[model samples]
Target: MNGFNWRTLSADELEAQYNPRKSVPDFEQHFTAWVERSASARTRLPGAYDLRYGPGPLQTYDLHKPEGSATGRPLVVLIHGGYWRGLDKNTMTFTAEPFVAAGAVVVNLNYDLCPAVTLDAIVRQMQDALVHIVAKAADWGTSAARLHVIGHSAGAHLAAMMAAAPWAGDLGARPQIASLGLISGVFELEPVLHISPNQEIRLDSAMAVRNSVTRFAPKLAGPVLVAVGDDEPQAWQAQSVDFHQACRDAGTQAHLMRVANANHFNILYALADASKPLCTALLRQCGLK
Candidate 1:
């Protein structure tokens, strides 16, 4: 190792040393551990309605209705981020509480995982769930126009894709999403493929671009806050920054912010307390604060 500066190693070599191939989000591990630790937490929220897609275990979402919340209240739909697999709706239970406290009905969604299916298929399944939610929103005490989406990591990418998806070509009805709150979001596919060598990443070249929020700006009804934790790897922050600038330049309402003293795993935790800057920022962006 003569003259081999450790810091000057190539990206691939760096990743090989830093990002182990087995290091995925581990949602299953987290979710199971959570259930075991917290015995009384129900599978779904009280009064939350369920609609199944295929033969798979009818995917569930926990809907939290704000006190005094009625049919016209704003709705924030949250998709959990566990790379592309690993997590379920339970981790997001805490995520729904604050928005509910903020007078918005909150829905934490779940879906099928990869290795069980491809990314494209999972996206479609999510879309179908959203379509059903949008249609039956009235029953859930909200409507599409009252809709907003907040996704972290993989969930953030999916939320952005929904904004860009071909509505007339597929669902016939356009989703009335009023705001987007992307936490630790990945907007570019090249980075996911080239950057962090994490096990949660497994996208083909085309899908990477196709699903990247930066590569495609969906028609957003209002401003979207792309936030990243300050302590994250440079590449993670860069992804959100590039997309935020692109959205703002395109005349779509967008801005980038830094979550102080936070990291990837717990960014959503900050979103749970109304007084926290990230939570405050999210509400301001949603026109709720």
Candidate 2:
């Protein structure tokens, strides 16, 4: 306990570090903007909506493909983050615009949240979603061989898990992930158990260890691009740095990006802007640039 990062802080103090709303006074503004932009994205882009990857109500994704060529294009899967408790794919639908325009198929995925489902169950659902997408790439007009994944906040943790899984031909005809981008992800879940956000997540010690990307390095063939806001809390930025270092130590290429003048909520918005460094980094990782 004395050596841990949270050792000097009380439980409340620790929770505050992980809670972005506390740090960003105008957090709700971001949500409001996200919803409005998402609605516009859905209407403006040509998409396949309500595609079910599993029988669960939330196990569905909305895929936005390039205007002219939908087939054989690289696929980019975006996972939304709500601390594994709240939010859905619709809030992040706007993210697909830039990637789609760049000729990448972007799929925004949804998963059953915690307090109703365990973290591991959500991870399995994400894996299943990828498998389903890869299995049907030809039908969807995407390429399984060039699949890339992106996740923000809790979704980043899930995306890291997907990148870490041992695909090894077991996916059967679907290629291994080409790369992954984790934007403001929680790499370590142990600290989360002590945070108030953990109530919904309901993570036990073992579950925390199992879900933590920092506990062990993920096996990724391509680079792991981690982006965080410079204005975010130290813990948030540290998560990306530590996870990026862990990936490097494990022989995986990793890069850390600090988005200037952005906070947790706005950093996500930055990812949607093509001119932003974070979005460019992600596109480069996917070989779209």
Model 2 C-alpha lDDT per residue in residues 131-238, reported as the tens digit of each score: 898887877678888899999999999999987754435555434788988888888877887777777889999988888877677868888898888898887777
Q: What lDDT is obtained when candidate 1 is compared to the true structure? A: 0.69
Each candidate's TM vs. the true structure? 0.82, 0.94
lDDT of each: 0.69, 0.84
Q: How many collisions between residues are there in candidate 2?
A: 1
Task: Please give the lDDT score at residue 154 for candidate 1.
Answer: 79
**Which 10-residue window of candidate 1 scores lowest in summed lDDT?**
16-25
Q: Candidate 1, which segments miss by more than 4 Å at Cα?
A: 1-58, 194-201
Best by lDDT: 2
